[model samples]
Target: MFKIGYRTVKTAVGAAAALFLAQALDLQFYSSAGILVILCVQNTKRKSLKVSLHRLGACLLSIVFSFVVFETIGYHALAIGLLILLFIPTAVMLRMEEGIVTSSVIVMHIYSLKTVTWPIVWNEVCILIIGIGIALLVNLYMPSVERELKRYQQLVEEYFKLLLHEMAVYLRSRESDWDGKEMIEAHELLHQAKALAFQKLENQFTREDDYYYRYFTMRIRQFEILERVMPLVASLSWTYEQSEMVAKFIESVGAAVRPESTGLISLQYLHELREQFRVMPLPTTREEFETRAMLLQLLSEMEQYLIIKSEFKGKHTYIQSV
Candidate 1:
């Protein structure tokens, strides 16, 4: 893999330049942030431009709403706290993550100010703008947009890996994995990426004649289905078959480790038997041959699915939303 060097320098430069202008204009933190935010947006050429613009608009609206609320109700500690709390649902309802983050930060700056220092407001806004602009510009220059775009594939792979880990967590939990927030976020990224990818494909391949272009569209839909279903099943814990195998595999593994006991049946038979029975049905007894096979068959599917998903390329990945 090619190492990226000095990409930060470009981003830093962009941020610095933008921040200075925002301060000079004496713009409120919201307006300044809006400009910088527009710059920070990950540029997928035209598609990224839209996202950045949309986020800027959303953030601006949120800031206005918060400002009006505070002005009308007075920014008491309780009021400010309530504003922030109320803003949370508003942000989600708006489908505006960046807006929420920016709006909340802006409210903080305003509430923190004993006096609304124009200079401080402008500086803060400029800094945010500059940071984003620098990052976006730097992203465009050194990373090679092609390499960055290949990240769509990484999203696919991540979804699968997270699915496996999430499943493992769920298997250990009765209801749901309490610590699954990060995994859920990772899965969300997959959907966001898919949405962005769809927009990019539409813009770049408007003609619909390109093969890879068409496949990319298909990939997004497939990813949507998997993301929705994987989380639902994450907490199912061990399937019926895997639970059955847990007991049998324990004894076999035990006998293998100690050689004092009969390792009855050939190793090849054990392999064939496990695969054949992994999915048939849960066995009543781990010692019973029929039951052992069913457990092995299911575990084998789980193991195989995990292995294939590590790379994020498989029939499962391409599956349409169920």
Candidate 2:
């Protein structure tokens, strides 16, 4: 979660060490330096390892990307002009999106600089590994967990902002609820929220840089509970057409006075809807408006479901009125 770029200061220590070796080895230091830059700046520990590897591999195998481009286009003069056009599809074929970017850059530079071969390529790779090793070592020795957690918090905030944004349909609709597009978008957001929730559940992250990570993950059980409840909430949402009869049937009743109907505007409706949820059934009781509010409050305000400490402790705190 740490920006490999932001770790430049920490990574610099590694760079210096790599430079010392590159110079001692009498290798092409500049080429090594560029490789180090890519390894250090463009990758995280393991998340985007593939992208970084692809970049390195692309650079390693760039003769292929470049050779194809130059051999195919070098004589035409049209090849240099349509360089990107020619290389991109090939990059895709290689399953390298960022690799293509790196490859294209390498291709253009190769065309302009006319340089490529193992004499320098292997040295570049070594330099890159050394630079990345520095960063990985720096991080391993003194991880930026606080920074990672801050990223987690930032992502959580983003999730909420997205959740709030997602609420436009639920808030605006009077006759219906979220449609397929909205639901699909909601599902995507939910997936993001779910992934973000894992950050909260995890506990390995630590350090000044990872303080937020520790905190964010500490309360993971709460989010886990929420995840358990989400599928049920989603089940409440039927297809626009599929649930049309159910929607209208519920709509016609005076939700407050009717036993079968929770008034469209009534908290009683929310309570009944929640009570009937199949995922985690709510306590059966004399269906009341207060009970509905309580259920919603539990989910809305509470962060963790471990203990029902107080009425306001959990989902109750953040529950908003319908």
Q: Highest TM-score, which number?
A: 2
Per-residue lDDT value at 153 in model 2: 50
Candidate 1 lDDT over residue span 167-216, tens digit each: 44443343553565655565566566556545445444243323233334
In angstroms, give how far residue 309 of model 2 lies from its true place. Answer: 13
Residue-level lDDT of model 2, residues 233-253, one tens digit each, is: 343422332133223322322
What's the lDDT for residue 289 in model 2? 35
Regions more than 4 Å wrong, model 1? 5-10, 24-39, 113-210, 215-322
RMSD values for the candidates in order, in angstroms, are: 14.6, 14.2
